[model samples]
Target chain A: MSKSILFGKTLAELNEICKQIGLPGFAGKQIAQWLYQKEVYSIAEMTNLSLKSRELLAQKYEVGLEAPIKVQVSADGTKKYLFQAKAGNFIETAMMPDNDRKTVCVSSQVGCKMGCLFCMTARQGFQSNLTAGEILNQYRSISEWAEITNLVYMGMGEPFDNIDEVLKSLEILTSDWGYALSPKRITVSTIGIIPGMKTFLEKSNCHLAVSMHTPFEEERKKLMPIEQVYSLEEVIEHIRAFDFGLQRRVSFEYIMFKGVNDTPRHVKELIRLLNGLRCRINLIRFHPIPDSPLQGSDDETIMEFKDTLNRKGIITTLRASRGQDIYAACGLLSTKELVKKQEKDY
Target chain B: MQSLNPVLITDSQPIANKAFLLQFNRTFIFKPGQIIGITTQKEIAPRLYSICSTPNDATVSILYTIKEDGVLTPQLSALKAGETIWITQPQGKFLFDGKPSWWIATGTGIAPFYSMFQSGQKPLKLIHGGRTQNDLYFHQEFQALTDYIKCCSQDSGNGIYAGRLTKYIDEQESLPPHINYYLCGSAEMVVDVRNLLIKKGAEYHQIITEIYF
Candidate 1:
């Protein structure tokens, strides 16, 4: 049977690894303890394991954790870490340290499938899902992990598209059996995966942030291709069923694209779409990626839009754009080093 | 230290929406009316969904609505049986203790009350306001929990006690003493209900609310 990149590995998979490495089957739990509990970087650091067992395990399946190869610091405190995927794909993860909390942006895939007209990764095209191990490494290897209080899936790939591995990683993160971070500290961003969105709402209790850049379908389709399949009207209608009236906050991610979707009429449509909903609108500053036709909306227009939403009784705030200097802003997350390496190999 | 006595509490589809029943483990010792935090799971940092399952129940559960064109709700809709998600220790101030109170809500803003109702304190009345029948979630629970007054504002469905929640509250001739008004759901509903509660001679502190975005 073929094994998954890193998912649904029952305790049996760990037992298989242990037995193959000449250790007792029960020793598998110890290995899990080291990997998920202690987060040991090197097999040599597994001092508690028998030397023979460590040697045997090292020969075949090395603890698959790699440190970040390159780190770029932006003028703002945002730091981007570049890592080589198992198959030589390049991926970038961002760490945004703030006053009250430090948030790390983790990528779900090497690239994405949504193909939003404006997103850089979409322009590059879709890649494979990051293994559960690969996804977890981004958190364990980041420089600010000690201070990191929050994580956002608003990085590179579409999280819902890679649901299995993503959910597995969450188990490790929240389970007393794993890292044990409260579910409250994590936020996932999606371009609207209807099927996946429903699962996430029922299965996960984390805060939900939707990338609702535009409430109008035609205009939204210009920026996000997913809008074609799942219309904005439909998305709002679906949301009308659940109650966000508790701590689980529902926030919409609105990226202001210069005069195109930043007019007064746009805000009116937004207010109408969100009229009865109890959610906040996060007005984001658009970061220009290479050769993208869209332009970032001017600050004045964004403020006006925000003002209109607030005036209409919707809670709206201008989200501070971070990591621009190091191409860590929205859609500017493709790793330059990885691109260069690919060119050299070609 | 977290205890490990997990229970499957209340699981029901509040609305015919694509949303699902929010399941929570009974690890955290929760009391009736205590709120909890829902964070992103370590693996996928999807946005958080604060649920309505307090620790007091045998199992914790909440109502959910899917987002059709939304990133979060759409992604969430894909869950299957036996898959685990992250949850935090219970934390919030929106639960209704045993008091004479009313909860005003609109849209999915009625979610948290699923947990509040299970938290064991029955209020005197719950004045619910929504646009249509599709908008009014948790009807049975509301019926069982307290004296419910339905207000369909935009007339999505007939047979609802017509008008706005604010209008409904204003028309009430007399309210019980020490009435604690709890408000959840839409931002407009909060502002409107809060103002109405004040006009009805309720103290500012007497009116507690969990303001949805």
Candidate 2:
């Protein structure tokens, strides 16, 4: 059997491994440097370690990074890269370049269990939860690894649903022993799983973006099933309780559905629900998927809605759609056809 | 963290293979199709279970199966009648509006539908899917319904459709397009049924789903 990969291990996990392997305690830091700081692809690349130690490490561990197997570049410079996840399942990552900022959208799970009505990923029906290694490998194995300035956990699955792996990936991305990226440059998006959201708020300093497509409870339940379990009222209350200082940010992602959620009533409710919260509203244009009944709100209606929110003291910005040609836009990332078939429990 | 309230198990019995119907004394009123968060201890994060009993019942019941690797279910299945368990107040918006609708479910996903049925709301049809004849819980209660259809994938018996539920839906000459369709199951089952319903001419709005995450 192949040994576990060392690339995704936190400093403490590496320390545990070092102790088990009978190496000096400080070797954990050295291994971390090679696996993360240097981004080495092999255990033998640690020339400072003794040959015996290197051989021992190689016997049980590999760097565990797999490069993207396919890439589809959009006409507008957005690139969608596909990587093989566990058990022959596939995941897509999008790299969008805009002037100086390069943002990479990474998936947290193989597919989504959250069956949001507007989501294409939900159609795939959740294959497996990606390990922290698989999650980080999407960032590390990409071609724009060096220049990528922003990371969003908004690709395929609900990041908070896989909270442990998502938190570990965040730690690896921001810790000094890992990639050491700023938490400000990272944003984790959730459809509002309360327990996971609370745990995330208490543990990480990264920005959070909630998928709040509508403000009304009934409408939101039709659009996103999570609203049924963790109501929008509860989610907002939790956010209100958390003290996100000036540096850390919180944002709501609203996908405008033509006739459903684009009306003035929704804007008023949005303002009322988020009255005292210090946050921004990211107004996203809905990207229609196959067999979807909903259509995106017209540009004029979206602009008007944004203006109403801005007038109400909420800092609302209209997010430009990207990678639509390659289906890398929001709610469009899915690998349904590539999922391995198994006898479903249902 | 949401505070949990202590409740005593009033009854616990196996309803099907690896599935159990657990009843606890009701402490709060709830809609027919609401869920409660359950845990063995105060400190542990609770898992949500759909209330399987009607609101009028003296005790609330929940249906669940033992997931071999789950943190809660194995312990939940081992509990006796007098033992204590912690649960949150009833919550969730998957309520069935007494409208003429089709209620579809699989395995323990039948909990919410059963709650609605026991609450005196009769669906236009109840299509239940299970792997075997033994997997169909509460079949006797549903057998009286005029449109109760049972689909067993692996086992075929009298009056049971000998295939997947989706197959039975696919073979339908024409599905009622006007009535609402409520689906509850794992993600795969819900997604598959929703897509099939849409393909068979049902509008997206007509199909409401509650997936087990």
Candidate 3:
């Protein structure tokens, strides 16, 4: 078996590992500085550690950062990189560059279980959850690592589904001993798994983004299966109760699917559902997928919908569609990489 | 964290191959298709299971297949009828709307469907998939339904389709685009079946899924 990965360890976990290896506890912080701050490629490059300590560490642990296997650049300069995850599975990470901002969207799992009608990732079903190291590697291993101004957990699998690792990655990114980045720059998205979402909201300081494709429960059930388990009403109730300070944000991601959910009724319900909640809604243009039953709402319909929400005092913004040519949709590229096979009985 | 209440098991018996039917005393009223999380110790995270019994049943029955390398199953399967089990409140809304629809399930995924059947909310048809004849859990009870199809991969005879449900669905010329298609199973199975139904002309909005992830 490969040596344990030391790259993803939290400061406390590192301290535990160091204590077990006969090294002073403070060496954990030193190792954190090298692994996170210095971004060393190998344990041998951690020169500050004594030769004996380095030998001990190298025998049992490796840096554990794997670079992307392939990269596809969009005409708009949005680059999508595919990384090999556990087993033979692959995960895609997209780095979208706008005028002064560079946002890296990272996937939390290899594929996904959230079977949203508009999502391409669900076709691959679920492969496995990516570790904190794997999650962070997307942000750190990319060529534009230094230029990343924001991180959004909206690439593939639901971030809250892999809550432990997602939280760990956020800690690594925001902790002083880690990247020392501000928590405001990070946002974790979910299809509303209540338990995991609650944990993320209570434990982490990062912003929360929920995929609320529709406001109605019956409509949402068909669009996203998670609604059957964790209803949007319950999710909203919890968010309404949680103390997300003035700085922390909770945003709803609404994917406009033509006549399906783009209507005055939806807008009215969205306002009623999100009544008194301090949050904004990001209206995303739906990307057409193969054999999809729905179509993206026309630009006119989407604009009117956004304007209606904004008129009702609900902050709404249109998310520009980027990387349309390079399978910019979160699951499209990774789904193409999947080898299709005939299904067998359970 | 869920507030777990200690409940005494009323019955424990092996149902299908490696699967067990565990029944515990009921404490609260819940919808037929709601699920409850169970564990031997409160400290350990409880695994959620669909309640196979009806909402008004005297006891809350759950169907579970023992995972050889699982954390909670080994402990749960070892408990006796009188042993205590900690459980969360009845949760989830994978409810049947008493509409004409098809309920598709495989293995222990049949629990919620069985709950609906027991609660008198019959699907137009109940299609269940399993590996063998024994895996067709509650088939005798489900037989009462006018349309019950069993797709068994490793079994023959006894009115069983000799393949997977996905193949059966694919072979269908067309499925009703208007009626609901309630799918309950593994994520892979749900995705495949949902996609196949979509390809066969069933509306995407017509398929409701409950994934055991």
Candidate 4:
């Protein structure tokens, strides 16, 4: 049998591993430093540990990290990297360089189960959830790892759906013994699974972004099926109830579709729905997919909608479209062609 | 945000191969298509199941199939009468609007539609898909409907269409444009069926889906 991975283990879990392996309790911190701080690729590379201890550790565990197998670079300097997941499934991560800040978007699952009508990832169907190791490898294995200043959980699948691993990844990213990243530099996006969202808010301090494409309940039900299970009303109410101090941020992602959700009524409803919440609205231009009935709102309509929202006291910004040629933009990240079919229960 | 309430199992019985119907006394009011959250223990996360019994029934019913590796269903399948379980108030927006519509489902996705049908909301057409004829859980109850269609992909039987549900839909000349389409199934089935319906001339807004995540 293959050994379990140690890269994603928390400090307490590593301590337990030390006890099971008959190593000194402090060896757990040493292993954590080797796996996370130094970010070693092989167990043999931990030169500080005694050879006997290293050999015993290697017998049952590995510092699991897989490098990206494929990278697609756009003319505009956006790069999309494909990594083979531990289960042999594929996931995509995109690195965008904007002026001084470099943002790396990471995926939480192989594909997605959310089945949003406009998402390319949903078209692939859900294959499997990525372990915390797989989720962090996207950041640690990329070429721009040293320079990355921002991380967004906006790549392929819904982060909240895989909340346990997503939270683990967040902890490893923010904990002192791990990546030591500021929680403010990271943002996790979701289509509003209420239970997962509430848990995330209560446990982690990272920023939250909700995919609220339309404010109308009926129209949102058609675009995103999660509305049927956890309504947008409930999601907003949960957010309203939470106390997100001054530094932590909350934002709404609205993908503008022509004549469908860019109408004036949607603008008014958005204002009413988000009246008191201290959050920003990101207006994303929809990128058309194969056989999709929706179209992106024209530039004029997008600007007018942004102006209307801004005039209504909501901080709305039009996100600059990036990596369209390489399919790394919003709603366009998918590994469908590379996905191998798996046996589904239903 | 409703808390889970403890309820005792009234009955549990196998309805088909690997599928079971579980019953408990109804305590909370729910629309036919809404779902209830159930858990064997308070510490474990609850799984949402559509109420498969009618509103007027004295007991609430949940239809489920045993997934060997699933956390809840195997335990739920092994429960005996008088055992205790936790359930939350019914919730969700997959309710039938009492309109002319088509109900499409596969496997245990048939639960919500069964709830609506038992509640006396007859759909214009019901397209149910399964791997074998025996996979159809409530066929006898639906057989009397004039527009009921069954698509069995693996095994053929009398009066059954011998292909996948998407294939059956793809072969259609055009789908009805005015009627609503309610799809409850796995992500693959819902996405495939929704795309096919759109390609066959149905409006995207006319389709509402509830996928098992």
Quote the chain B TM-score of every prediction: 0.77, 0.98, 0.98, 0.97
lDDT of 4 by residue, B13-51 (tens): 999999999999998788988988998988878888888
Docking class of 1: incorrect
- Candidate 4 residue spans exceeding 4 A from truth: A86-88, A330-336, A343-346
lDDT-superior candidate, 1 or 3: 3
Q: Write the residue-wise lDDT of candidate 3 on A181-268 in tens digits.
A: 9999999888888888888888889999999989999899888888888889999999999999999999999999988999999999
Q: Which number leads on TM-score?
A: 4
DockQ (Cα-based) per candidate? 0.01, 0.64, 0.69, 0.66
Q: What is candidate 3's TM-score against the reference?
A: 0.96
Model 1 C-alpha lDDT per residue in residues B64-121, reported as the tens digit of each score: 5665755445544554445555554554334456666776666656666656676665
Better of 1 and 2 by DockQ: 2
Error of 3 at A97 (Å): 1.0
RMSD per model, one decimal: 18.7, 2.0, 1.8, 1.5
Error of 4 at A322 (Å): 1.0
**Per-residue lDDT tens digits of candidate 4, residues A1-346?**
9999888888889999989999888898888888888857888998888899899999999888888888889888999988876456678999999999999999998778889999888877777888888889899989899899999999888898899999999998999988899999999999999889999999999999999999999999999999999999999999999999999999999999999999999999999999999999999999899899999999999999999999999999998888888988533545544545565432
Give per-residue CA lDDT, model 2, range A25-86, as digits (tens).
88899998888888579988898888988888888888888999888899889999988877
The residue-by-residue lDDT of candidate 2 on B1-213, one tens digit each, is 678999999989988789999989988999988999999898878889999899889999999999897889999999999999999988898988877899999998899988888888889899999998778888889987899999999978699998999999999999976899999988878988988898899887787888787
- Count of backbone collisions in candidate 3: 1
- Number of clashing residue pairs in every model? 54, 0, 1, 0
Give the least accurate 10-residue stretch of model 1 chain A, judged by summed lDDT.
Answer: A337-346
